[model samples]
Target: MDLLHTLTHRHTTKAYDTERKIPAPVVAQLLEALRYSPSSVNSQPWHFFVADNDAGKAQIAKATSSPFAFNASRVMDASHVIVLSARNTLPPEYLQTLSDQEEADGRYANADARAQAHKGRAGFVGLHEQAGDVPVWTQKQTYIAQGFLLLSAALLGVDATPMEGFDAAILSTELELAEKGLSPAVIVALGYHSDADFNARLPKSRLPEKSIFSHI
Candidate 1:
């Protein structure tokens, strides 16, 4: 599919068909896309929790209850719910882990190359820590991955709704993210649009390019 067509056609799906499910292979590809998503300094400080079954989705839906109850049905009805999380800290050990993986993957040309790679990435990570908000910085990187997932899902003809309306604290507790040193950043529900999804038939809307973009 053409990139423009996919972007133009994709909209925030408000309702989903509960019975439609994504194929396992397609789910795998979407996950691979997330795994390979680019991050600043290759920090890659994010984890994804996927709920593809009713029981799992119900657990996630619990976070959307009460004041956020409107989102509960969407979470429950979607074929899958993906909770994207950011690491609470970008410690030296995590950077070392990334460096080790890179070395194992032959990303370094030599010993010096490996050393330089670690130095550069570690320096960038230090800047975030020195700024005193590693969580915010790390959460920002997760949005980049979310963008990739949005576009990839469009290409795969999957309807997705990116949501930040739920209770983050509730989600964190429900997912036990604190135990993993992670916090919820965003949630995306994926599935087919329901026949009653009025938004799907509406023309996509956006501000004029002249007002929203600048050539300079």
Candidate 2:
């Protein structure tokens, strides 16, 4: 399908059919899409926690309690839920790990090239750290991955909803993310829309191009 067609048809699904599940192969492809998502300085400082089973979904549902009750059913009813997280810090070891992986993947021509790559990435990461908001910078990169996942899901004809209404702190604790140096950034629910999902019937609305875009 054309990319424009996919974008036009996709909407933030409000209700999902609990009985409908994404096939394992398709889910794997979506995961790949996220894995290959672009990030600043190629830091790739994000982790994805996918819940496709009842027990896992139940754990995520807790994040929607009380103040976040509005999105509880969206979590419980979707075929799968993905918790997007950002690393708390860009540790030196991680940059070394990326450098090693890049060399192994034949991204550099020689030792000098590899060193240069590491130095450049380290410099960029150091700048962010010095700014004293590394977590926020890392979280911004996670959103880029989220955007890729959303577009990939749309192209696959899967209904998805990007949700930020849940409690992040509760979710991080429930998912034991802090142990992994991760913090919840956002959640995405993926599945087929329910028959009662009125949001699908509503006309898609957007500002006119002239109002939102300009070319110098």
Candidate 3:
């Protein structure tokens, strides 16, 4: 695939074709991309809630009420909606769980290597905890996963809308994410765009690379 062409053509979808649905196989691939998304220290502190059915979508759409009403249709009409969430706190147990998983996955050649890996990741988590920025740090990682999902969707010929306009409190309550020690970071709607999507027809715009980049 032409990577530049894909990036240039991908746009945030506005209106979706309600009649269209993404094939299950394609959805699986998108989820895989999200699973492999990178995180600082390999913390992997995230959980995803996927909604494909009307009831589930409606539950998520509740958060888009009031000022965010504009995103309701995008949520309700899309083929799939994923609520990306981050851990409320990165407790030692959680960090240890990740360490154990890494060992199980053969990420370490020996016990000493495993211990060093855990120490490195825990040190970073400790720094964030001391700064009272654990939540912020984890949310940043969640957005990395969001980026992966959006790009993967684009590559699969699926339209995607990354939404941060929803009411977090409403979404957290509806999804009971807080009960699971998670908080909603973002929502992504995926489907095919409809004729009503004005954004699809607009040309892409951005500052020149020379203006945004600097060379040593």
**Highest-scoring model, lDDT:** 3
- Predictions ranked by lDDT, top down? 3, 2, 1
Better of 1 and 3 by lDDT: 3
TM-scores of all models?
Answer: 0.98, 0.98, 0.98
Which residue pairs in model 1 clash with each other? none
Question: Per-residue CA lDDT of candidate 1, range 80-181, in tens?
Answer: 899999999988888889999999998999999999999998888888788898999989999999999999999999999999989988889998999999
Model 1 regions lying over 4 Å from their true place: none
Report the C-alpha lDDT of model 3 over 1-216, residue by residue, as the tens digit: 688989999999999999999999999999999999999999998999999999999999999999999999999999999999999898999999999999999899999999999999899999998999999999999999999999999888999999999999999999999899999999999999999999999999999999999999
Backbone Cα, N, C clashes tallied per candidate: 0, 0, 0
In candidate 3, list every pair of residues with a backbone clash.
none
Error of 3 at 106 (Å): 0.6
Instruction: Write down the worst ten-residue block by lDDT for model 3.
Output: 1-10
The lDDT, on a scale of 0 to 1, for candidate 2 is 0.93
lDDT, model 3 = 0.95
1-216, model 2: which lDDT tens digit per residue? Answer: 999889888999999998899999999999999999999988999999999998999999999988889899999999999999999998999999999999889999999999998999999999988999899999999999999999999999899999999888889889999999999999999999998899999988999999999899
Could you give the C-alpha RMSD of every candidate to the true structure, in order shown?
A: 0.8, 0.8, 0.8
